[model samples]
Target chain A: MRKTAEQTAEQTPGHDAPRPVRATQMVLRDTPLPPGARWRRFAVKLVALALIWGVLTEFRLDALYFGVPAILLGAALVFVMPVAPGWRISPAGAVNFALWFAVQSVRGAVDVAQRAFSPAMPLRPGFRSYAPDLPGGAPRVMFLNTITLLPGTLSAEVAGDEVIVHMLDTRADLEADLGALEARIAALFGLNVKSRGST
Target chain B: MPDLITFISAALIAAGAVFFIAGTVGLLRFPDTYCRLHALTKADGLGLALIALGIALTASSFGEVFRIALIWFFVAVASATGGHLIATHARRVDRAEGKEGS
Candidate 1:
């Protein structure tokens, strides 16, 4: 099922890449969650949910009556659900990415604000397709989300390996920006960075 | 110290409001849907971050601060996702109308 869908996606013409329908199919076809990982996820989620409940209820002891069962149910749902492959986040890389994202978000906002306030409204908007080196999963989704927060780029669609980006200014060097972001994301996810070929 | 904190918080929040105004203006004035998505996502993301930081500073308890941070995190995710969805829909509509890369 997955093989045929991917082949069809690849064969489709460039101008009209079909909307991605693989996520639900993947969920259906996914292997059973490993016992160790399942327990680990349950434990972590239980603790996190407990903490959130404590905060929400201001840590009243009486609230435990409701919170305990609710939290247990919520965390146990993880066991029954198909686990999407998890990304192993690097702590140092996450800190670095967060700092970079914060700075770039400010720059992105300023860039748009300037254009918005300008009398001439200088915008050279166009779509450019990029083939990401990152695999089709969490890393690619993160990269796409990050593009919207970066300076002058918004991800319009993702058809297979190709992501169509809408640029506020077509003159900007998009390859450099996207490449830098992909590298940062790769580091964060502890994945090997691959050099992207020319699109 | 409290006075200084208050002043800083007020300043940050005011700065955030300015960005929100800029974002709204861009949404109104931009020539097309894609450009407007750029304006909405970037400006509003930063604007909310600044505002949330300012509010976190003023929060009375650590729990309150954590809650504020969580709110900011969820908003950031939602805004990014929403922007992408809107852009995808607009692109599809345009493509259907035989407009490519406007």
Candidate 2:
């Protein structure tokens, strides 16, 4: 599998086709921004900036003098950057993902701690490659990034469609975990990703 | 209520400290670099997160609480990314050396 991946990487020459790139660029460069969407982005960014300023200044009324222009400058930064089409976020899905992530993070930490503190060290560390079903772009990048934080799994590299993951225990059903995470992330982005069968 | 909050905060902070110690133990005792990375990333990330949560509970203002939460989030991201980079480099070196898992 590594040889095949390296061969494909060579064929691509200038780029590794499936490797994840900055998703922000995809958001802005995918298509020309619509006027209404552009205005909405500006408004949202302005509100977020204002809220940040409010927090930093601890709601000082006098600080509004400097805060307003600072907000404008922050919004201008967003405007100058690439804005991807369909930037709408699913708030409900996001909340669910956050809850799930928190739970998993805690579980992962506990599991590792248990292994670390055990008298008889029980670890079968190994590397495996998985072909991600998520389409190339932000979703893939998100998947790769999210996997690293999960329990017992670390993504070594994302070459083309295959992500090489290092596992603390080879016995664990990592592909299933990856599938569940993929589905949750896809729901957050409102993207439809086909589920791959667990190995 | 103040007493209860203080107790909870102390307990959480102590628990976080325990995790940090466990991570350090694993770093010293684990057989390989990859195993150590697992220990460092997961345990340290959770330790910092628990500490942040404990601190946020006693925060004087909503903004201060949010700041604590933001710090935890950043820590989580940084630890994960940092761990991945180290693990990748280690794996590459292992492969170059024709060690196991190559």
Candidate 3:
């Protein structure tokens, strides 16, 4: 199965094609950003950093003496940083994803706590490799990070499009859960990803 | 109203503390690295989040509340990234040593 994945990756070098890299050799290759897009990203990052500064300093005018330079430096660093392919966030989808994430975090914590307190310690831990449908970028990274917060799953390794997930219970329907999570992330990014079990 | 808010905050904070205890216990009791990572990430993530929310409720101003939330956000991201890094390292070491899943 791993060999087949590598062969396919070698054959395809498209934007959505997964790179044939080992888990340890996972490096984010930067995609060239247009001048207009670069400036837009800088503007967005500057505003975000300024808002963070305002919250941290309680909107104090005197704090701007330090905050102004820090914000500019932080925003300026974006230009030198590798610019990966970006995704557009949908406001409605973000609200939905946030609500779902909150519920899942509580459920995941409660599930672990119950097993920890139980005398039997009913844990059937193992690893499962999943082929994610979301393209390799912010959407895929979000899916991996979010998996750790979901009940009974932690993403361990990523090889190409395959993510190895450590699960507390192997018997759980992980495929469905991963598919749903991927769908939620795709929605959040306004990307139309194919649902699982579909061609 | 302030008194009621205080009572609720205290309750939420106490509940958060319970999860922290459970997380610690799981860390000590779980069989191996991966399982323990699950316990650490999930329990502590929720624990800190609950504590942050509780504290935010009592914050003096909106800025204070946002600051508390920002702390929670940063911690959550850090913990998740840290957990994944540790898990990856352990997996690599296990493979190099010719051991199967932990």
- Each candidate's interface RMSD: 3.3, 3.8, 6.0
- Regions of candidate 2 where Cα sits further than 4 Å from its true position: A1-43, A64-86, A136-138, B94-102
DockQ of 1: 0.59
True contacts kept of each: 0.77, 0.59, 0.67
Tens-digit lDDT track of model 3 for B16-55? 9999999999999999999999999999899998899889
| Candidate 1 vs 2: which has more DockQ | 1
The per-prediction CA RMSD against the true structure, in angstroms, equals 5.1, 5.8, 6.7
- TM-score order of candidates, best first? 3, 1, 2
* Model 3 stretches astray by more than 4 angstroms: A1-31
Task: Point out the higher-scoring one by lDDT: 2 or 3.
Answer: 3
DockQ for every prediction shown: 0.59, 0.52, 0.48
TM-score of each: 0.87, 0.80, 0.89
DockQ of 2: 0.52
Candidate 1 local Cα displacement, residue A123, angstroms: 0.3
Write candidate 3's Cα lDDT for A128-177 as tens digits: 99998776567877888999999999999776668889999999999989
| Number of the predicted model whose TM-score against the real structure is largest | 3
Q: Candidate 2, residues B5-69: lDDT per residue as tens digits?
A: 99999999999999999899889888988788888888888898888888988989998998887
Question: Which residue pairs show backbone clashes in model 3?
Answer: none
